[model samples]
Target: MDYRNESSDTLRNKCAACYRQFNKKEHLVEHMRTSYHSVHEPMCGVCKKHCRSFESLREHLIGPLPKAECERIFKERGCDICLSILGNRTSLRAHRESCLSRPNNNGLLYRMANLGIQDELRIDNSRGRVVALACKMVGGGSDGSLDLCARVCLIDEHERILFHSYIKPNIPVTNYRYEMTGIRPEYLRDAMPLKNVSRKIQEFLCNGEPIWQIRSKGGRSRILVGHGLDHDLKCLEMDYPAIKMRDTAKYPPLMKTSKLSNSLKYLTRAYLGYDIQSGVQDPYEDCVATMKLYMRMKLSQFHKKENYPLATDPQNKNNFASWRQNELERMTPDQLLDISRSDYYCWCLDSQDY
Candidate 1:
């Protein structure tokens, strides 16, 4: 125990492939047995820590127990969500300027109302109805309390702007989060109150139908689409039926290989070949991105119709999990391919007729 002559490599059993040091040889052997570690594993941008996966990288950067020094610097120069370090105060300032201010016509509500359209959203009856929702948050307190919704936008499947408004929060705004939200005190001074915005959004989403009616009687309710929708909806003080939600953040196929959800910006770039949320966040752009992502998943041919509710039904868990070794071996390649293997219920299951 007193010996200081051991080589560093021997003291820390480092895996050859991943270069991760384990305290014991047995742990390194166990890691290798899974065949999970590789050189391709994501590395932290700042610390250069080789993570086992993107999820590990995310936890390293932003999770509860992040590296203290990295977290401190990250708070000053890094994007909390994307984990991108902006490098120096000047660069971060420039990034903030572009990030918060999207190029669009000013006076969102006035422009939408004066277009000679009805107050209610005009849903296209022919195509499957989908509506995208986005919300901007204003800071609550210095203690990182819940942010209030300061703005909201809703768009249709046809990319039509249905509703947009600056919402006055119920509580006083402690942090405008101007760099990300692009909201100023003057903007909210004359903005519509939270109650009015909530009422309008409810009317738009429900399409003049009661919530109960939509659930029980198969009434028409526009499919709600967005990224991190639950958070947005919570901030907006709004609710929608769970089954009708098509969230880019929760969709299984769009998730990371580790089964962790990818950021909306990342997903947009990967799937749609475009960048978004690069600077001041625009709700309209967010709506469009979510809508596009939702449509892409809904129209995917990867999901076979025959799989149906079986992928989600808890009752079938035993049947699927307890497949005999002999039974699996006996299956033809085509038969094995036919086996349902989705991580989540397909959104298309509700959107289209099988």
Candidate 2:
């Protein structure tokens, strides 16, 4: 994807979504801010405008979001009041408590532990849900426990998979009671072979989108998937996406517990009712678990009429919601994974973006 000297006639630096560009990177970024702003972050409700800068986003949402969506963001940022709609959960709560508008400080909604993600999020209110294109996870050994090894897996909307296996512990190698468990040092015997591991992942991601770019849409067009993908991606030393990822572990309702486990075994049992590994996990098996979980969640959403709140209200076509969704079922896994991003408006994560 080099934009080098091919031909001045074809030299174009258009934004992928809007087909706009500029001579400099700074201008390009600024252009994205206005054109893709609705998808990147969010627009102010009352003013019907979008955040012009980081500071402006903060000044905007200091008021309120539905109690539901507000709760989800609060959990990620450690229950802090957040002004900018783009930040994590903790910051939102901070704003809710400080802004005169924060609902009742009812301890019911403010549970310290509940500060992870909300059970129900504001649908269609923001594009964040529709844009999540992939998943990530950190596997803690193969036998459903963490004694042996930890590797992170990345899966995107197009069914692409990448894994970065851990090698030596940052902490000095030491033998603890759980030492020789599932992936015990005695069992593993040698280091993770980092170079070899890197090569395998490089090949897998050879044709897919990077995690950060996948999340930029803040909705379903792109999907980065995995159980508890956040921790593993963060640990892998990758740039964070402002949107577009499908982390089963932290997804609403299911996220009350682990950050998508990075553990497919645990996730499959909890969400899909199937066990993933007898010993070490098979990458294919892990991919299936994540896919099933995603499908399950999506199917459930389809049943809720409100999930497609924006769909040209079947009851009244005059007032249209601008999106349509019908399950693509009885199809092969490959078929499901191959879906295009244009259908991003179909996901039911929330009721707004569609």
Candidate 3:
């Protein structure tokens, strides 16, 4: 009479919800929710942390998940897929681009996270020269295409570096000519934005006394510099009169009678005996080249404005001044470009204080 079914005497080791074997109380409890109703699953409601299943989770759970904290962390960190919630959007975008590498495909999202909000120019008034420099290490293709963030070195005219920022771009423009300029996209993923460029520049320009002091001082009536000066002035949108600027491009004697070669490469080689090469022409170099060329051509002013024979080159030094006086006036633009490439001899003349 006391006898019972052998199966009943045995402990029910298997779980009723999922039919899974569970020897311990905890296992059974955990599996119950996993195999039972979906609502009881252990899941982070806010961050969507999934669990085994709703039912098992409900029964086995000890404490509720702090979804707010999770959400806060999520927002603090940049989400590559969802940029809005990410803390470091630039990094997130960079990861996304690396994830999807393609031609014509710039790292746009990264740029937005890093671009400088204010892109105004800075001028220093006390230094009597523009001091601020916008240094950017951009990444991407070429043709001024900027996609990634890179190191931007902010320096002053006195060789003092002011600010170094890691900026991102607001707009996505791939440096189309990246190869020509040697800019690597992978390198600029964490650089500063162009927004702060103007602010720094304005700060530098303002600290200086003023620009155009040479014109104000009545020196040369105009500043005779080199070819790329236009681009330099254009960058900051500062204007100077044509007479105030003596572009080597506009000179003719340098091109024809110098016999020094029309190209800056050959001219620099012949005059300065140095090679002129750069991954890309920088505004700083542009200013230097223009200054040098302007100084080298000062002798032309002493010329008598006539055309000399091709044979009357540097070899005929005795007749050089007179010959140039006769020939320098009739030279072409290409010729001037050649002469402007030489060492600035105007320093010698200016030394005489004439």
Candidate 4:
């Protein structure tokens, strides 16, 4: 089935969704089978090309060898951050102004813990909600090589402080990371113990449901949003099911063009249009940043309506049936794309369930 025997000028088999050329038609078919390119994928605003992720879309728009015409159009009207195409120069200017503006969450939203309270978060019993968690770490052990969670903060979807506490590490702290964390020796001297903080966080996140119940999907486990949650959770000596965790650093749409995780500061500026972690790191600020990011992603409304019976759906496994190979081979790339589905679940889908 090799097409290398054919002339170079002859039409080469190519994937309609990603535009990857194939030497054989069967290879293209196999690619469509595994790629699952659906309408839900991130697409270029200029050319209407579907990409595997936002990173891929960015590459298409502004990478080393972008589509010349598309790049020209995008350079004029495309939003560098969200990659949206605006109507005109004025609209693009206004859109960029608003798009890059930093969100203003009033300081009054903070509900600080009273000095008399012991290991208490003032959040009410409206369970099964989405919350963002962020923890600031201090250096522990000799030469400050080990990370210890010294502060943790949680905020509900509305950016209200649900839980915020300074944790006293089980081990002695060697570096409070004063310049970045602004945590002093006194903050940990009489702060809440790690065990108590861990228990309260676990209880709050689980919403009084047992681990098994939450794991079974029968319980209302609050969705945990964060950046680099694995590091935070590891430092805190706690574990949460992956299904309930939404790490902005790991979410495809918010990643770097290189497919690497972007730092919170970079993501905040690029996507959220604000700068964070500029000087001293605040867990509450991180919580708000992460929550804002989560909300923005969840509120995405621009993606085309999901196709029914997605290519990844079990029943749609035989997307290009062998019996219809002749018909599929004759179809154009755009036609093939119409029958494809996204390989990964879009985060916007979370809005529907939540």
Candidate 5:
């Protein structure tokens, strides 16, 4: 009686590994060999279906011809920014309210008012100065070959905004990427020119001291913090000393099991106990998230204080070859764990106090 189900079950070949269906058994075998679909593959947030790649996953969720059932549900409950399908309409509405709200000067005003400081905040002669920066991109050409910096924001350690501005691109914009970037052509039409923006950012980052002076002194220049800072800096045509940069994307603890860096959305949700970039990408939101992540890592209890200035210390070299055989054998497991190890020289080691 159930001929349709019986016939389909008998005819269709499925991979037990990834639940992918194939018309023929040999095809399934071939797919298993080449596809290598595993738990590590990116999965659809709505359907939990494994995609061959992130591009495939994007197509499944938001392409012209998505799965009808998943598309319907996603339309009602999914966040366009992070592409996550939340539980219900009420929850999604609450999330959208927070996600869509623009960051304002209220937080900065409160901090300044509380401190009772009328003078301008300056980074000059300051120690352990940290500033979070974020940038928004607009399409550069008709073929989407390039991205230009359209907006930038800077926030201090206290979540106080220092600078926020829109930058006009030199090249004509083919796409505003409004759905994610929340930038419009009108916003950039009368914005600051690229040259001016670059100069201003350089001044702020350098804090009145020359690059060489800051590199030698290590106190005048502010530590730049953000996610995917290389891309942002590339778009802005600006550069900072790598020693003074803290990029959350490349941080080891936040990476995937496969050793690939995690997305900011996932990192924020996992560590900060909330979601961001849900409806539109906000530079301010991103800055705050990155700053918070940096602070959290800095304040981690596992951090060893003995490894201060880990970059400059030649003795801190963790290579096993450098260690004496007797010393290595004599070391306890706990002492072995105490040996300073990092994916990259952590900038946290540069700060005397966080």
Candidate 6:
């Protein structure tokens, strides 16, 4: 009788997020309510098992006592960086090659192209310009605790510099942090004024469309890619529509195992397999690193539609409604996961055509 009861318990429904088994489907739903499971949580591509951290996911894949079948499949198709399971070995090879390439700045350097009419830009084939931005800050205020933007750089998808300039700070700079920034007082002496630089970047990002229209998809406004864009834009005294921004630091897949923002330097080395910001940080180098990361994510070919939550769709309600409790309890574990909705938007969605 005890053996029979144990076997019945093995058949219980499990919450994918917390991996808690329940006797009933409704009980599993209740567990999810407080589990706070989200798309940001690291998930196994094979079994769709969600883990609390990338470390847990890594263990589930290759650590001791891994799931037998999942470990078998992941060994064949998993990506070490993004942890995505590709369709085949060929796809995995191609994906890994792109995912772990060293950063390169082969794009055209700063120059006045076509007598400066080209605006120092190399445009990609995208509907609007997709640019990566980076900024270097010198400290200001008492005890050198404040950030004052001293240098800014923008690069296109091809890693070509669109704009690079030192800014004359509105306030006095107390610490240049020369070892890291390589910025000296002389660099800002004849630099462009903050207002002019801000206006130029604002106009360039909007691309002649009204600022209000930037929120709309596929509009003329440029897509801004960078790490920590909130702070960068804040320092620049500029505003951009949130939807148009692709911030690496905030993107879920690139986050640390603990769900915190990863440093750009660490992300570059881990994903791109190269060091950056090791010496005096160059804004151009930072821009290139971010652009590579953005392109890698933007071009991801992972299957996402089934797990994506179209929250606006009235028909896409949660699967655990009371009326369907019996039906859900009878479904397999994989089916339960199929009906589960991701709590955050996946970046791979950006590759989809509207």
**lDDT for each of the candidates?**
0.64, 0.37, 0.36, 0.75, 0.66, 0.74
Candidate order by decreasing lDDT:
4, 6, 5, 1, 2, 3
Candidate 3 vs candidate 6, lDDT winner: 6
TM-score of 5: 0.61
Q: List the residue pairs that clash in candidate 4.
A: 36-341, 37-341, 38-341, 38-342
lDDT (Cα, tens digit) per residue for candidate 4, span 171-193: 98998888988777877788888
- Comparing candidate 1 with candidate 6, which one achieves the higher lDDT? 6
User: Of models 3 and 6, which has the larger TM-score?
Assistant: 6
In model 2, which regions exceed 4 Å deviation?
A: 1-171, 175-181, 184-215, 218-222, 255-267, 276-287, 303-353
Quote the lDDT for 42 in model 3. Answer: 29
- Report RMSD (Å) for each prediction in the order shown: 12.0, 19.3, 34.7, 4.1, 13.5, 4.6
lDDT of 2 by residue, 1-354 (tens): 555653332224334333334454344444433332223222332333434332233333333543344444524442212232435456555544543211112222222222221112222323222222122222343343333223333333233332323344333334422321223444223445434443444323322444434443342333445554555444443434524456665553343332222355555654454465554333334555666666545543332233223223344332211232123222222232222121123234432343
TM-score of 2: 0.34
Model 5 residue pairs with clashes? none
Question: Which candidate do you rate higher for lDDT, 4 or 6?
Answer: 4
Highest lDDT model number:
4
Off by over 4 Å in 6: 1-3, 16-20, 31-48, 51-56, 62-79, 82-99, 105-128, 257-259, 306-308, 312-332
Candidate 6: give the clashing pairs: none
Q: How well does candidate 1 score on lDDT at residue 289?
A: 79
lDDT of 5 by residue, 1-354 (tens): 897976685345555434666555545444543443433344567677765444455568778888888788888898654456789999898876644423344534443343211122455644237889888798877786598998888878887777777889988999899898877777888888888777777787888778766663346678889999999988998878877788888765455533578888887875565677777677777898898778766643233455333323566444233344445434432243244233245444544452
Candidate with the greatest TM-score versus the true structure: 4
Clashes of each: 3, 55, 79, 4, 0, 0
At residue 100, candidate 2 shows an lDDT of 21
Deviation from truth (RMSD, Å), model 3? 34.7
